[model samples]
Target chain A: EAGVTQSPTHLIKTRGQQATLRCSPISGHTSVYWYQQALGLGLQFLLWYDEGEERNRGNFPPRFSGRQFPNYSSELNVNALELEDSALYLCASSLVYEQYFGPGTRLTVT
Target chain B: EDQVTQSPEALRLQEGESSSLNCSYTVSGLRGLFWYRQDPGKGPEFLFTLYSAGEEKEKERLKATLTKKESFLHITAPKPEDSATYLCAVQAVFHAGKSTFGDGTTLTVKP
Candidate 1:
């Protein structure tokens, strides 16, 4: 079975612009999670969606939001992107605790 | 809030050397502990998952063991290819098993 897949391996956007990243979970997975990893930093939780419902969010600002589709794919949206938002945005899919991650989309805000 | 901390920010060993990495955690109620290996520019690859204290899991040359407050990843006769960042994560039962990740320990094996 294919693991999680992400789109737009790299994204470039100017500050104050918007950015969107997409993810497709492995078949039979119902939970999708979004995480951000800045250079030299740990993974920070962003959002969690289960069964098409927003289940949890991290300490990130309101500008960070996402939604899961009916088929378990997910999209992460960053509004009014800031230079600090330049990082690797990773998407993961799982049934419960053990999540399988995607290659991730590297977003660079200029 | 659930938290995780990994030690030895970085480690260097000779090929065939054996060592262990540590992952300390604090959670309301641990649902599971996970281990992953990540390359410099790629997503993490799943390694193992331990559900409770005293639980152990192994894969290839890596063995992961868990206790109430921490987990340890033991690597034996590591090869250069085994060099990569090792990450530990914990899921809290109250949080419905959502994971809290550690910054990770980067390992480098010399030829």
Candidate 2:
């Protein structure tokens, strides 16, 4: 079976713009999670979507949001992006316990 | 609040060296502890998951053991390819779908 897959391995956006990152979960996976790995910030949870509903969210601002589709794919959207938004956005999918991660999308805000 | 702390922010070892990394956690109830390896420009790759204290798992030259309040990743005989950042995370029963991750320990293995 294919592992988690992410689109546009790298992305570049200007300040105040918007960015979108996509993720396709593995077959039979129902939960999709989004995380941001910023410099010296460690890995910060952004959002969690399960069964196409927003199950839970992190402490990030409203400008950071995401959604999961019927097919178990997810999209992470960053609005009003700031230079601090530059980081590697990771997507993971799991059933309940273990989470498998994708290659991640490297977002660079200029 | 649930928290995960990893020790020795960095480590260096020669090939065939044996060492271990530590992960200490504070959670109301630990549902699972996860270990992952991440390269410089890629996302993390799952290594192992320990459910309860005294549980252990091994693969290749790596062995992961969990205790009541912490976990240890032991590398029997490491290689240069093992050089990467090892991250530890914990899922708390009360947190539901969220996880707390440590800053990670950067390991460097030289030939």
Candidate 3:
């Protein structure tokens, strides 16, 4: 089966700009999760979406937000991006317990 | 709060050498513990999931075992291709959909 897939392998944006990253979950999966991995750091949970509803979010600021569509795809939007926002953003889809990840989108903010 | 901690930030092993990576976690209610392998600049690849203590799962040269407070990924007779960062994550029963991940253990196997 095809695993989770993300678009825009790499994205570059300047500070104060907005960036959008997209993810498509595996077939038959309804839960999509977003995470950020900064260099030398662990994965920080960003948001969780199930059945097109936002279930939970991490400690990130309000400027970091996202939504899940009816088809179980998700989009992460970072408004007023900062240099600190530069990191690898990962998307995951869960069937039950185990989550399958997609090749992350690398966002570089200058 | 749910938290996951992985130890021995890095490890170097010669081909055929065996070792183990540790993941310690604390959560309100344990739902499942997952192990994943991640290559540089790539996403995590799921390996195994342990739902309860004393659970064990194996694939190829990797064996994952779970305990009450921690889990271990044992690599036996590893190859150079096994080199990558191994990540551990835990989902709390209450949280349902969210998981907390560890910083991960970087393993380097040399021929």
Model 3 CA deviation exceeding 4 Å by range = none
lDDT of 3: 0.95
TM-score of 2: 0.98
Residues A8-106, candidate 1, lDDT per residue (tens digit)? 999999999999999999999999999999998999889999999999888899999989889889999999999999999999989867899999999
Q: fnat, candidate 1?
A: 0.67
User: Model-by-model lDDT, in order?
Assistant: 0.93, 0.94, 0.95
Please provide, for model 1 over B12-103, each residue's C-alpha lDDT reduced to its tens digit, 9 standing for 90 to 100.
99999999999999999888899999999799999999998999998889999999999999999999999999999988988863679999
In the range B1-84, model 3's lDDT, one tens digit per residue, is 999999989999999999999999999989999999999999999999999999999999999999999999999999999999
Instruction: Give the TM-scores of the predictions, in the order they appear.
Output: 0.98, 0.98, 0.98
DockQ of 1: 0.76
| Residue A73 Cα positional deviation in candidate 1, in Å, after optimal superposition | 1.0
TM-score of chain B of 2: 0.98
Model 3 / residue A107 / CA error / Å:
0.2
Worst 10 residues of 1 chain A by lDDT: A90-99
The TM-scores, chain A only, for the candidates as listed are 0.98, 0.97, 0.98
Give per-residue CA lDDT, model 2, range B1-111, as digits (tens).
999999889999999999999999999988999999999988899999999999999999999999999999999889999999999999989887887899999999999
Deviating ranges (above 4 Å) for candidate 1:
none
